[model samples]
Target: MSHLSRTLPIKRAAHVYLVHEGQLLLVEERMDDGSIFYGLPGGKANAGETLGDAAVRQVLVETGLRVTDLMFVSLIEGELLTGTRNECYANFGRFTASFSGDLAPTDPEVVGVKWVPFEQVEGLVRYGPPPEVEERNPLIWVPTRDFVRGQPRAYYPI
Candidate 1:
């Protein structure tokens, strides 16, 4: 396999959007450079882990919240461009789940956590959708907004 294709599965991750009263549970991820971006609480899944388990673990670890009553909402897949050049990192299999728990920041991975009103996510998106993404990039919002709207399809490269 080519170098690009060989690294296609490097960054597989999952996210859970715990919505209650039109608010989304989001995490302020801290970049190595001290910048931040807001996004649903989640992280990488362990080997052979189920999507649901990954969702719950990520949410609890990042936000100090236990996700119960969770349900599969959507499936998202797309390319993730890290700081690495021409790497073509694949951050596919983004999924959203519903759940409930007291909101708090539980993991050091996140700089901060907040429950953003659904209407406000757009503003956050404009400011840099998620710290996992390259700041000031428009592609970050493409998958997030689609997930929020119950449409998880990513625009596959043509």
Candidate 2:
């Protein structure tokens, strides 16, 4: 394997946009500085784990909710580069699922999990690595919000 190919590996992940009662279920993270951040309840796909399986496992782990009816929504592709290292990040699959169970944060790093109303999403302040060092991964996550809003969808980050 070439050094460049090894270093610039493809990081594949799957994330779920789970909705419940007109609100989107999300995980809340509190930074040490007391600032709060929110994210969809999913993570990196395990080796040999299909994106659908990973999405199910991650949501259960992070939010204590069981989900089903995974529907394909979008494929988020972007390259994250930092210094000499490059990560060809591919959120190759994205899905929406319906969930059951009381909302809670099973992961210690996740402070809280709750249902966020659609109107509140804009101010939620999505984040990514520093745009300069880390090639930006969709500054605005279009798949989640658009899905929740029931809007016509095309992929782009604002």
Candidate 3:
């Protein structure tokens, strides 16, 4: 482990890969700089909450969807850097989830909810899994396809 890993705080997040009919569920938000950002329907886990529970709760709040049968697919560990300094370590748990319900965003930060076509996802999502993670685990990040359910979970460090 590097010095930063030993010194920096860790932030644990849970994100879902909710695919239906070749489209993925995405939450659209406006960043501080007024740029639009598209990301998965989940967020950081709350205190004392399991990652799976966080995933379900975040999905419900962000997309009005009830998710179930979560299958763990990947774990991505990376540093959230501020220029040359390491700010915090990000540990993200990625899951493939089964969800039901219509699209409705309840979160105030969420400006919209979209079902992006699989092929268009890569170009649309500005904040995504790190490149190292995506390159090593194409099945998890590839824009045109979904990872197989029950596939062995993979770990990527960035």
Instruction: Give model 1's TM-score versus the native structure.
Output: 0.72
Worst 10 residues of 3 by lDDT: 131-140
TM-score of each: 0.72, 0.77, 0.79
Clashing pairs in 1: none
- Answer with 2 or 3, whichever has the higher lDDT: 3
- Model 3 CA lDDT for position 101: 88
Cα deviation in Å at residue 36, candidate 2? 1.9
Stretches of model 1 off by over 4 angstroms after superposition: 1-9, 82-91, 94-98, 126-137, 149-158
Q: What count of clashes does model 3 give?
A: 0
Q: Model 2, residue 46: displacement in angstroms?
A: 1.0
Candidate 1, 1-158: lDDT as tens digits: 23454545455566777777777777897766676767778877788887778878888889888777566554544455554453345443444455556667768778888878767887886454343554345664566676666666644331
Model 3 segments beyond 4 Å from truth? 82-86, 127-153
* lDDT over C-alpha atoms for residue 137 of model 1: 57
Q: Residue 113: error of model 2 in Å?
A: 0.5
lDDT tens string, model 2, 1-158? 12344445666677787765677777887765466777778888888999999999988889888988998887766544434345454545678887788776578888888778878865685455444422123443666656667872644322
Ranking by TM-score: 3, 2, 1
Off by over 4 Å in 2: 1-7, 32-34, 81-86, 126-140, 152-158
